[model samples]
Target: MSELLQFVFSGITVGAVYALVALGFTIIFNASGVVNFAQGEFVMLGGMITVFAHAAGLPLPLAALIAIVVTAAVGVALNRLAIEPARGAPVVSLIIITIGASIFIRGASQLIFDKQIHSFPAFSGDDPIHVLGATILMQSLWVIGGALAVFAGLWLFFTKTLLGRAVLATSNNRMAAQLVGINTKFVMTLSFALSAAIGAFGGVLVTPITLTAYDVGLALALKGFAAAMLGGMGNPKGALVGGLLLGLLEALTAGYLSSQYKDAAAFVIILAVLFFMPQGLFGRKSTDRV
Candidate 1:
């Protein structure tokens, strides 16, 4: 039982991070109808930027804030520079563009930050808290708390704010949204910015526990993408559920089976979910309009 509890605790921590990344994917897809494969790059930037900034004598909190803001700006720039110019292109083109952008960012990170793994001090002291005979690190709590906070904030923003409604309207139908006075372009830009900010924030929160390196983004992106797919690509609720489920499965697999196959666990689950329900857990089925 203690062993099981341990796995669950660890899984939830990692799952929270995955959930945040999945949320980023959902936001961008909903707004632009394009999957930003570069989503993980934002996370990489958050951790890498904060590491450098803090090393250069900035406070950790300030460095994190700057990282989130800078990543958000980069997201806006990505929309204007890459996605905007190629708007209305085939889905394959958009996918290739985002994948290319991610590769470019990874290369840049390797040059700027080098290939060494780096991490920072946790927000709280590195102490373990025991719950139900399972010990969890203080940083784990921070990550979980951060994820919940983000989810709550997003829920409020989407339900209670005018700008959020405009974004939703644009996602529903870009042409109709524009006709109704919503600036679809601005909505697109805002979606990218917000999505990037969320991804970066997750990186900042988890870096202390996971450590980080220039090349970590791809794996994170893949897992998050899988989580999004498992939950239903465009559904925020799906993203959250899928992420947590994937994490728990991985954890249990590693604990009971083999740690070496931890990564494969997620893919297995994805395959199983796809086989059983192609639309994902929360995804709504749709028919093409002929």
Candidate 2:
């Protein structure tokens, strides 16, 4: 039971990071109808930039703040330079574009930040807190708290704010939104910025635990994409549940089964879930009215 609790604790911590990644995916997908393969690059940029900044004598908090802002700007640039130009392209084209962008970012990061794995001090101390015979790190609490706060904040933004509604309107129908005087182009830009910011924040929070390098983004991106799919694409709530569930399952598998195949175990469960319910756990079915 103590061992089981330990796995659960670890799962929730990693799951929070996955949830953040899934949230990024859902935001971009809702806005542009395109899955951003480069979302993980934003995470990489966040951690890498913070590491560099902090190394250069800036405070850690300041470094993290700058990283989020810079990543957001990069996201905007990506939209303007790449996505906007190919506005009417096929989904395959967009996917290729994002993948290309991801590669570009990774290569750029390698040049800019080198290939070293880097981490910073935790927000609090490195001491572990005990819970029912299980130990949890202070940094893990920060990760989970960050995830919940982001979810809550986004929920409020979407439900209570005008600009948020405009974004939603644009997501529902870009043409109609434009007709209704919503700046859908701006909406798209905002979506990318917000998504990138979220991804960066996740990186900042988890770097202390996971340690990050230029090459870490690809695996994170894949896992995040999987979480989004498992939770029902384009749904924030689904992303949260899917991410946490994936983490828990992976931890359990690693604990009871084989650590080497833990990721494989998680994928198997995702495939099984998808097989029975194509729409995913929280996804709604849509049908056109005749």
Candidate 3:
């Protein structure tokens, strides 16, 4: 039981990061029918920038805040410079553009930040806290708490805010939204900004545990994309559940199977889930908007 509980704790921590990534995917997908593969780079930028900022004598909290803002600006630039120009292009082309952007960001990061793995002081001390005979790190709690808080906050935003309603309206029908005086272009920009900010926050929370480097974004992006797909492509609630579930399964796999196979094991299960339920756990019909 102790061993099982430990695995669950580990899974939840990493799963929280994946959930953040999935949420990023969900937001961009909702706004622009295209998957932003570059989302992981935003997370990478968050951690990298925070590390460098802290190293340069800025307080850790301030560093993290800067990372988030900078990454958000980068996201906005991506939309304006790359996506907006290709507005009427095929979705596949837009996706390919994002892939190109990911490569560009990775290369740029290597030049700008070097190739060193980096991390910062955890929000809480590294001492493990014991619960039910299992030990959990303080940072893990931060990750899980941060993810849940963001989820709840997003739920409230989508339900209550006028801008949020405009997002929903645009997602439902861009033409109709514009007819009703909604700024569809602004909605797309907001989506990218929000998505990038979430990704950066996840990087800030998880960097103490996982460390960070210029090249870490690809795997994170793939895993996050898997989580989103597993849950239901455009559903926020589904993204949250899928991310946590994926994390749990990955933990269990690493514990019972082998850590070497952990990634493969988790992905294989996701494949099975997708094969059986193409629309995912919370997905509605194809016609339904986020």
Candidate 4:
């Protein structure tokens, strides 16, 4: 029982990170039909930048803040420089562009930051608290808390804020949004910034536990993309559920089955979900407007 509980706790922590990454994917996908493959680079940047900044003598909070800001700016630049110019390009072209951008960012990260794994002190000391016979780390609490806060904040922004409504309008129909005086292009930029910031924040919160390296982004991107697909491509709620489910599945597989195949579990589930429900678990069925 304790072992089961331990796996559950670990799963939740990992799920929180996956959820944040999925949220980032949803934000950009909603605003622009293009899936930003470089999204994972923001996570890598967050963790790598924070680690270096903290090592350079900055306070942890300040280091994280800098990482978020820089990553947000990079997100904006990516939209403006690469995606925007390639507007109307083939989906294949756009995918290549984003993937290329991710590779570029990873290369840059390697050059700028030494090729070493780095971690910072957890927000709270690494104290373990027992829960139902399972021990939980304080860092895990921080990761879970950060994920929840981001979800709540995004919910409020989308449902209550006028700016968020503008974003929603843009997503629903760019032409209609422009006709109604919304700057759809600006909305796209904003979405990218918001998504990147969230990804970076996830890195900042989880790095103490996961550690960070320039090459870590690709795997994270793949997992996050899977989570987003599992939840329903553009549905925020689906992303959240999919992420948590994937994490739990991986954890249980590791605990009960074989630790070596934990990574395989997530991919297998993704394939299974797609095979059964092509539109995704929460995705809406689209009909052509004749």
Using all chains and alpha carbons, the TM-scores for the candidates as numbered come to: 0.98, 0.97, 0.97, 0.98
Model 3 whole-model lDDT (C-alpha atoms): 0.93
After TM-score superposition, the amount by which residue 190's alpha carbon in candidate 1 deviates from its true location, in angstroms, is 0.4
Model 2 weakest lDDT span, ten residues long: 265-274
How many angstroms is residue 190 displaced in model 2 relative to the true structure, after the best TM-score fit? 0.3
Q: Give the per-residue Cα lDDT of candidate 3 at 74.
A: 94
Cα lDDT tens digits for candidate 4, 127-196: 8999999999999999999999999999999999999999999999999999999999899999999999
TM-score of 3: 0.97
Q: Model 1, 242-277: lDDT tens per residue?
A: 889888988999999999999998788778878998
**What lDDT tens digits, residue by residue, belong to model 3 across residues 2-114?**
99999999999999999999999999999988899998999899999999999999999999999999999999999999999999899889999999999999999999999
* 10 residues in a row with least lDDT, candidate 1: 265-274
Task: Tell how far residue 17 is off in model 2, in angstroms.
Answer: 0.5
lDDT by residue for model 2 (18-81), tens = 9999999999999999899998898889999999999999999999999999999999999999
Where model 2 places Cα greater than 4 Å from the true spot, the runs are 288-290
lDDT of each: 0.93, 0.93, 0.93, 0.92
**In angstroms, how far off is 67's CA in candidate 3?**
0.1
Better by TM-score, candidate 2 or 1 = 1
True-structure RMSD for candidate 2: 1.2
